[model samples]
Target chain A: MTDQRDDKEFAAFLAGESELADRYQALGSEQPPVELDEHILAAARDAAKVHRLEFGPPGGWLKPVALAATVLLSFSLVMKIGVDSPVRYEQVVTVSKESDSTLEGQSEPVFYEQLARSLPQRTLEMKNMREEQQSEQVIEEVTVTGRSRSIELKDAPMAVSILGSAEQSIDQDAALLIVAEYVAMLKTKSDSGRFRLQEMERSNESTAKEPALTASSPVASKKDWESIDKLQTEDDSESMLREIVRLYTSGSNNEAGTRLDEFLAHYPDHPVSVKLRRRGY
Target chain B: MLPGMANRPDDKVLMVRYRDGEVQAFEVLYARHKGPLYRYFLRRGLGTEPAAELAQEVWMKIIRTKDRYEPSAKFTTYMYRLAHNCLIDLSRRSAYKITQQVIGDDIDVAGLPATATANPEAEAIYNESVEQFRSALANLPDEQREAFILKQESGLSLADIAHVTGVSTETAKSRLRYAFSKLRQQLIRNRDKA
Candidate 1:
């Protein structure tokens, strides 16, 4: 489908073999004017000058100085931030502490009110402990007295028939009953003597001789007995009723009955006495 | 290649050296291509003044965009592509003016730079043939004329002509073939009339 003439012409064009090429070369001998050449060369030189200024030589100091300044600025910024952070944190902590103190001050009255409310309960606990201690002391005194009487009786001649062996044994039992009654009376003052009982049980063997030595002296026993008598006189009816209950729990019905009678005699019109009477004490 | 062109550095190297702030490299490059580039614009249907101006503009543009020039293609291809684009831009800006100029006149050989000829009579005949060739080139269609001009002015490969004119190699070859066939016909017709 191709024309041979067109192919020849295309081939000649590729080979640059046409007469038109030589003529075209002659036609293209025209050069740009000298003034135009001067203008362009001057422009190129000026451009190269501008390029040199913009992209300085590789050996120039400006780049190194710029890099150093950048590094120094970065280091300074980091150091400043690092130095300031702890102070800022401390300021925050101080503010928090101040706020906490203000809250503590605001809550002080509530704390005192709670303390005031707890005082009576604490006082009741102390009173119970003291009463239990007193009861124990009374038992110790009674035991010492029984033993001293036995010793006295032994030291006396056999002709002293007024305090024989049988009489001595009966007196010991009666003394035991008296000590139990006294313990029942003091026990009324306590809501709970469980802690005191535990302490006594632990210390009983170790401290058995200590109280005997202290209470064996007549003067010491009298002083302790006077304190017990004063406590009994000042004992309130409510605590006396509690003693009756404690004696009942201890399987000492006679002692409980005696204490109940004494409590009724002291406070006949008392509400606790009325309750006790209803309970058939 | 021109006389002593082989002795000098490559065009791409000269451009690279110029890009690195060497004025002498750019001067050498300007000297090497200025005439051909001016004639390229002239053969593309531009008057001498306009051709000179466009050639200057192309060089200035090359100077402006020196940093962007990559050595990926032949320097001739790159330069001609820029020249082609400038020509297209000028045509778009004043299509009527360029059309009138293209149709108005043929090249005046007297006004052209003198060649170092050994014989004056042979030179005169060659000059007449050159004038006829210029007329025939101007009469050719714009694409064919540009294809022919790139071929003559830059001595670029057919592929390079295709690259500069943004055409396929086959299309560039076809344009060049048609240009040569028409120019030969015009020259023969003009000679026969004379």
Candidate 2:
């Protein structure tokens, strides 16, 4: 209780209600050494200067941006030196020897050969079309055909159309002569294989050679047809012989029988005719 | 600290100037408060070297954190609070129990006995009793001594003291009352004996 009373009196003394407050206040706080004050104040001034540099309008943004750019440049250099670049253009050219057609009847080996032979002409037509579109300083034109990815960059602009706009057709007369010769050689293999002593009377066979060989006969030139019909090779004769045998095997007996007679008249001494005779062709 | 010195900028105004990119303003503020801050740590019984280092650290913190300064409280309250926290951090770092041992623990605190003889050469024993009074002040408990020193040094009100010390206003008042009761008794007894 006495302590509580003394507490009030002293509180009053601290509040300057008594003369004792002056004497207490007269007991002054100690002073720090002059060196210490200078050191601390110098630090404060330096810090204030740093703050101004960091947040002052232009300097603030510029330092950070330059720092960021430098960091990005460093990272880019590290990546360039340390990591290997991959080979970007890897090419595997696969020649497809197998036929893709699904047709089941009447599509003979000769027909497929003809289709394969037309491929170069078809590519020439597409190249012609690309040339027609641009006449500039064409640095390079590389066309990869037959379904393989190639390792060429199309550095120049090209309008490459792979569809049916290309009208690349072989001469109709040569195509027909090829078919006709094939038919005759095939007939010789199946017919009685001796030279027919009588010539194929041209007057008798004139009707058989009428507009010729399809629902839509080829629009071939007369001179071209004459030239192609007059030309022949032994390998072509063998292939043609195979084609005639196919015709007979397919049961076109009347046509095959007459064509056999014509083939014997044309190539009477073809050595394989003797074999046909033995087979009672 | 004087009420009549209104012509001079207050601590808060100088802090605002420093916050607004003025270095001279902070220098003015540091000059005003360095002595009181140094004495606050010195009286906590930290040796002169440690006390000087701690005081320097407190001012550094104020400078470093000037951008975050707000005028919600008096600058003296904020400054002493930083000082108080610096001392607490030092106490913990030193791993000393009874971290803040009041002012003279490092220097004047030689564990003097409760009696003393007056010097015959002195005209009055006022000077001698003052020293005794300081010893008695140092002998107060940590919180009570802190309250008395803050009141004497910073002249903060009870509410501001409470805010600075993270205590209630009533707790601050009670601490101040206890400290005053103790220090007053010691000083009065010493003066009577002299």
Candidate 3:
């Protein structure tokens, strides 16, 4: 019961203050040394410099240039690998089977030989045929090692005729012919890969001559599409700003100013900028 | 002390001037707050030297963070908060423990020259009461002690105390209440003994 009373008494005593509070006030009223003022002010100045160092330079142009380079390089690589490699060109071809009555027995082999060479070139020309006639034209015959298939060519008035003799087989499927032509083109292009490789080597040599241009150009850095996994994570802006400020206040004003200008341009309404403006930067 | 300087520009404006290479504005700010800040550390069991050192440190922190200053709060609030943190930091570094011995701790009350033989009995009573009060204040929790100091010495409102200590007004009030209760109990005990 007395402990409870003491708790109440304690509360009341604290509420009912004494002159000790006044005495404490008097003790604290003593004047501080004059040097203290200078010390603190100097500290504040140094702190201001630190703040300036942490938040000084804006990096406006550098970011966009970096982003543009990244985007352009990425897009160029993707196009180079994905969408551009399989393009097809078509042309129409007129086929005529030679009647070799003198070499009747050997005529089949000669016909097959000529057919193999002419078939691919003929297919190449077929794709260049006008779109209106594309559907009607077809491969009337296809022979692989004497096993032959004959397909009926649609005889529409617009159809481009592909004539062949009775001994030869013709497959007149338009879609199959188109695909075959595309495959043949791919083969031809692949066969000439060494020449293209030589051309690439020459371009690379020329590129090395103008290093600055190569470095600046977006197209020069195009890598394989799969290598995009190597892209760096974005840097932390606050730390970057700190570094920029440090650079600025440490007598690199021009570099710092450029970075600061860049940052302000990028983030016009940033709180850091407000602080910078207030600091008379 | 100059006329119309009572409604002076805020710290932010002064800081901006300072940033513009005007050192005088910084001096003015230093002059205005240095005494109070020094007193703040002194009252919190720090010696004159330590108080001055901490005051300098607080000001230095202010300078370092000047470029990041937002005038969302009063300059005094910001400065005192810095001082408070610096004191806490110093205490941690020095491992300084403040004892609650009142008159016997640093000064010898019995050794002081007698001011009045006429009221020796009353003087003894007063001294005892003051000692109990100091003991109770020392016994309070750190938060309560801080709240009481901020209120009693800094003359900050409960709201202002909350802002300085990063507590809500209700928490500040609660701490004050606890502090008051503890001190009141000690005072009453001294009165009972008398």
Candidate 4:
């Protein structure tokens, strides 16, 4: 019960009603020297204004420039990726013949790669054609005779016409595939032997009855040599097999590797496996 | 919990303005509390030079950390914490030369000599007891003196005292109790001689 009295007295002292509170209150407060206040306050004011630009926002004009550069980079990337859909020859839209005139005037390696990836079949064939011809040979433009006038197929729908012997070298097989599609298109339109497919140096005197190319008819220009090479890969299915091998070996897909094992059991003599054996796989 | 300064914008408002880069806002805050904060360090046993140095340092620290300061407590509570930390750092830097006793949490304020207000001689004793109490204020243990001074200077409640001194509210109340008890006894003990 006496402890309660101390609690009341202590509370009174803390509340400044007691004599002890009167004594502490009697002492006046101390102030920091004026110079210290000026020094500290001056520093506080200075801090608001003085600092490196990077610690805050960049200058006014820089943000737009950085934004523009970022946008330009993104656009270039998206254009380079092309479409995601499965590619087909039917999907090949023909560009205007007049477009060829402009394409033939410029020479840049970038244009060659753009034209190559634009058509999947031609990209593969173009790579092959580049390897075979060693890329020094000049490309010949094919001419198609329309009913009203002789229109060169040089600017035909496929990417080949886009090259048009511009100093930019491209895949020969790309050019041939374009020619085949153009030939197919022309054969239906011109019954008169006005349509002729041949090397630029070949005679124009050749007649319209030149065998209307059978749907499956081989391209006559490289029929014998290219046909034999195509037949060999077709018989072995080496291209498909090589692609599966590439996917498995690169560890890009576990499913591909599992399939490769199943494939090796049935076809252990597959060319890539045989090749790996020679390399001490 | 702050009262009676209703028209004056609080430290939090000034702090927010300072954060938004108005240097004048910081000047207002500095002017409002500099005396109390400086006196806190001074009375806490830092000599005048070290007290001034630490006061400058506390302002600089507030400026340096302004952007990260959230108004999580009363501005007085926050500033006093900086003062508390600065005192601790001074104590540590001086290798614990602060020989003040550890003020304990014994809140048992029982059976002490009763406060005397009866004698007319108490009036004559008051002036001298005031001087004695001021001397005793300097001599009180660190925690007791800190609690007393913070209460007298900032008008912080025991809860705010707990926050400023980094102790529980109960401990803060205990320290304040012990502080007033010592001051009362000191005043009366010196009253007779005076």
Candidate 5:
């Protein structure tokens, strides 16, 4: 309790209620030398200046903004690659080849030859239409057996339309004709094959002069009728032979039998006729 | 006496403004606390030169670490804590011995300027009582003397004294009480002898 009383008295003395407070206030007053204050204040100014430079206005927020911009730019580049460049011209060509079963196993030159031959006769009308709309540069050159020719079918932009028009009229013989043309085009690699192509053309010409092969005939298909009409008016022996082959392969057995008999009566010595006889046609 | 005590800003606010490169704020703070801080070291057994050095060291530390200063406690408490640590560090170094002699023994008491009193004899007696108080204050233990000085000089409360001295409020109060009792006893003995 005495200690507590002393504590209260000391608290009162600290509050300046005692004479000791007055005496203590009269104690010596000393100040730091002016030189020391200047030295320390100069040091303070230097440190504050350094700190101002270190955390300058741009230093704090610019780093994150630049980082975010870089990330956005990279993301946009990846999106452009993924979204815009999806299909290539080369891939379209591949898909076109894969869809056609007959074009399988053919070399590129042979494939072009077959593509040209298998195109429908209506493609001729489209060729006339295309010639009006496009420049001659639209034609692409193809090389077969060391002989390069500019065929209308190559690089033709209307290829899908050509196939679409041929869907109803193309018979088995037209398809086989495409294969045969591919084989003949590939065979032209040798001199013997060239001579054979020339001989076939000559025999076709000779058969055109024969009256029996020129007899009037009925055709099953409108396309075959067009070819026959063309043969009658123009006397194209190649067209006649193609029509006969079309009738034979189109399941018209009786019409093909009559056309074959009449053709063989005039051209018994024809190489194609001899080949047909050997094949039991 | 230090200047610019009229309507001063908060000490922590002054420190923060100084941290933001306003040197004028620091000048105000230095002017406000320089005398009390110097006297604090002077009365704690340091010679005038060493006490001045310690006072400057404490301000320099305050300036250096201004960026890290949080206003959690009173700025006076923070400043005194730094002063306290510097004294402890000086004690550890033992480069300057802490003496137990009366603070008045280092100076000529007659050379001190007389207090402004109309009665010269009363002023003389007042000077003697003041000198005796200083001697008694120096006679107290270092912790008690430091507590008393912090309370009287910096106007720190008992809790602030505890915070600055790393003691509990009760312990700070006890030290101040013992210091007051000792000084009062010494003054009474001197009065009786005279």
Candidate 6:
């Protein structure tokens, strides 16, 4: 019952019809000192200045220029990389020819040796015949012979008998085995040939090739052979391997050391490995 | 400024003008509500310096954040909410000490001389009674004091009070009830003394 009375009194007091309400109203009427407005406006202006300074000039253009430069630089770098890469067209063709010759040579070593020996003579004869035929007629013919096989070559004519040896000579089951072995051998020969060709192409294309030969050339008068010799001796993979072994033994695995480890793992029997092992490894 | 013109612009129009760099629109808003915002801080027992500082900060905040302002509610509601936040922020920063005795003592009873209809002796008695009642109001909890002040000073409806206080209407009403009951008890004690 008392709680009910308290609740009623509280409700009536909240109505604000009492003396307390008037005093609150009077308290609300108190005025603050007048300088606050100036201080706050000054702060706001400073903030506005900061906003303008940070975001105003060139805000519109910076993004597009940055974006355009990024795109242009990326495109230029890609084009430069593409252009600077050594072309391997001749290398690829050499590898393909070596692989094909290896395949044909594998089936009959004696025949291939005989053929290889006879090629220079045959080429000379063909050259002479072509020289004679060129003056008289547009048509030309030539003959080629192997140990047990012969072929007649004519202009624009393809000989299919060279490819028919395995099919004709071997039993059907044995022929498949020969074909598989031939393919595996061809694949191995092609891979090694490709690597060798690529190395040759890179060496031919780079000025880094044949420093010793260039050093001896009379035309290369201005060349500093001593510095060249020093550089070559320093850059010799053997020296690099020795430096790597020294670092590893000293427990100083810097970038060169890391690169040496990678090099060793990648090409363990590389020519420098012998020197590397002799030095420390 | 024309009377009430500062208060009369549609909040949306004022906001749009303010966005377009019409500083006058913001000045008008400041003028329209400066008295109410000042009163809000003053009634909460904040000193004159802090109250004025908080009021100015509230306006500055409105100016700084004007670009983000949307008039989804009445401008007056938004203004009071900003003022409330500034006051709370000021209190937090200063950790201002608010005491019931200080609140009660700060009220100037001399300013409100008793009505002439009462005998001089009786007026004196009434004035003392009013002072005592003010003291009791100071003793009320901060939320109750704020709810009571918003109701009396702004004439805000319960919903408006709730919106300003960030409380439900029921909670606001409850606070008001507690504030009034405490004040009524003090006034009743004063009436007995008279």
Interface CA RMSD of each prediction in angstroms? 2.3, 5.8, 6.9, 9.1, 3.1, 5.4
Over the stretch B58-172, how does candidate 3's per-residue lDDT look in tens digits? 8777776665677777777787788778867777887876434321244323433343346988777555555555556656676787777776665567787888888898898
Top of the candidates by TM-score:
5
What local lDDT does model 6 show for residue A273?
A: 35
State TM-scores per candidate.
0.50, 0.48, 0.39, 0.51, 0.54, 0.42
Candidate 6, after superposition: displacement of residue B108 in Å?
A: 7.6
Q: Candidate 1: where is the Cα deviation over 4 Å?
A: A1-9, A58-281, B1-5, B100-127, B187-194
User: Of models 5 and 6, which has the larger DockQ?
Assistant: 5
Off by over 4 Å in 3: A1-23, A41-281, B1-22, B91-135, B188-194
Fraction of native contacts in model 6? 0.32
Model 1 TM-score relative to the real fold: 0.50
DockQ (model 1, Cα): 0.39
| Candidate that scores best on lDDT | 5
Q: List model 6 lDDT by residue over A181-266, tens digit each.
A: 22212212232211122332333244352223222223112321232233344344433433343333233445444655565676
Candidate 3 DockQ, CA atoms: 0.16
lDDT of 2 by residue, B1-194 (tens): 46769689878989988887788888888778887787777666676677788888888888888889998889999998898888788778887554444454444322233233365555235546656766777788888878877877767889888987889999988888877777777877876776
TM accuracy, model 6: 0.42
Per-residue lDDT of model 6, residues B41-123, tens digit only: 76677755666777877877777887677778767677788877777776688786655555543443444444645588866
Residue A46 lDDT, candidate 3, scale 0-100:
65
Where does candidate 4 clash, by residue pair? A94-A157, A126-A171, A193-A208
Instruction: Summarize candidate 5's per-residue lDDT along A146-235 as a digit string, tens digits.
Output: 223333332242332322332333333333432243223222322322213333334435554322222222212233123223433333
Please say which candidate is ahead in TM-score: 3 or 5: 5
Q: What is the lDDT of residue A195 in candidate 3?
A: 15
Question: What DockQ score does model 5 reach against the true complex?
Answer: 0.31
B1-194 per-residue lDDT for model 1 (tens digits): 66976887999999998998889999989998998898787767677788888998899899999989888998888898999889889878877244424632555546564665869887777667666666677778888888888888777888999999898998998888788788878878878976
Model 1 chain B, poorest ten-residue lDDT window?
B96-105
lDDT for every model?
A: 0.60, 0.55, 0.51, 0.56, 0.62, 0.52
Stretches of candidate 4 exceeding 4 Å from the true structure: A9-22, A51-182, A185-281, B1-4, B99-127, B188-194
